[model samples]
Target: MLKVTAIAAALLLSGPALAQHAHGAQKGPNGGPMEDVAGVHAELVVSGQTVAVNVFDEAGKPVDTKGYTGSVMVVSGGDRKTLQLTASGNALTGQAPGPVQSGAAITVVVKTAAGKSGQAKFSAP
Candidate 1:
């Protein structure tokens, strides 16, 4: 029935497994790929063992992240790890379990202090 279908759609969109993967965004000021996440832009940067996500507004200007929390899910070959991020300066930062493998795929998920959530994905360079 229509009611059942609507309920299912709502649940699907609100579930943890539902991530709006934005892949067509241009590179950001930090030389990382930027994607529209929630109501802002998120740039994913991986260097050494650090995974950082820079948040920006729709205009690509850096934004404040004082109350934002985020995490990075890195997958390379058969290895996978989730890094819990901490807001540092104006970016959300986390430490990977090991060196980020070449050609890995990264997904950055973030939530504001008010509980607004969004996500962005990146392909390793």
Candidate 2:
């Protein structure tokens, strides 16, 4: 019983280290911050009043946007706006009601055709 308790404690202690490894440092191909979502990478790029979210696989290859639906919430200058994204080639694009400035906080949530879903947070670049 003591051995089992020690093993359990060790496992619990290593959980955070393992999780950090799984989501370790990632860089977007478009010079933006990248994050893992639903086992894939989501890169966010914002310009003027348009925001583009490009999805890529673990290997950094663009993923097909077929049947993918998503939304982006951008907060800038103390104003928050939510924009519906539509599939466009390998990326999803949306036009915000107002200009999305650099360093704006953003949250993206997506649902794939396969029923997989995930959300990621980023700062507009």
Give candidate 1 misplaced runs (Cα > 4 Å).
Answer: 1-25
lDDT of 1 by residue, 1-125 (tens): 99999999999888755554444757888888888777788888888898889888766688889999988889998888989999977799998867897689998899976789988778866
Candidate 1 backbone clash number: 0
Top-scoring candidate (TM-score): 2
lDDT of 2 at 103: 82
Query: Model 1 misses residue 65 by how many Å?
Result: 0.7
- CA lDDT, every prediction? 0.83, 0.84
Model 2 per-residue lDDT at 43 = 83
Candidate 2 residue lDDT tens string, 5-114: 99999999999976752443456778767777776788888878988889888678999999999999998887999999999887989999878888888999988878
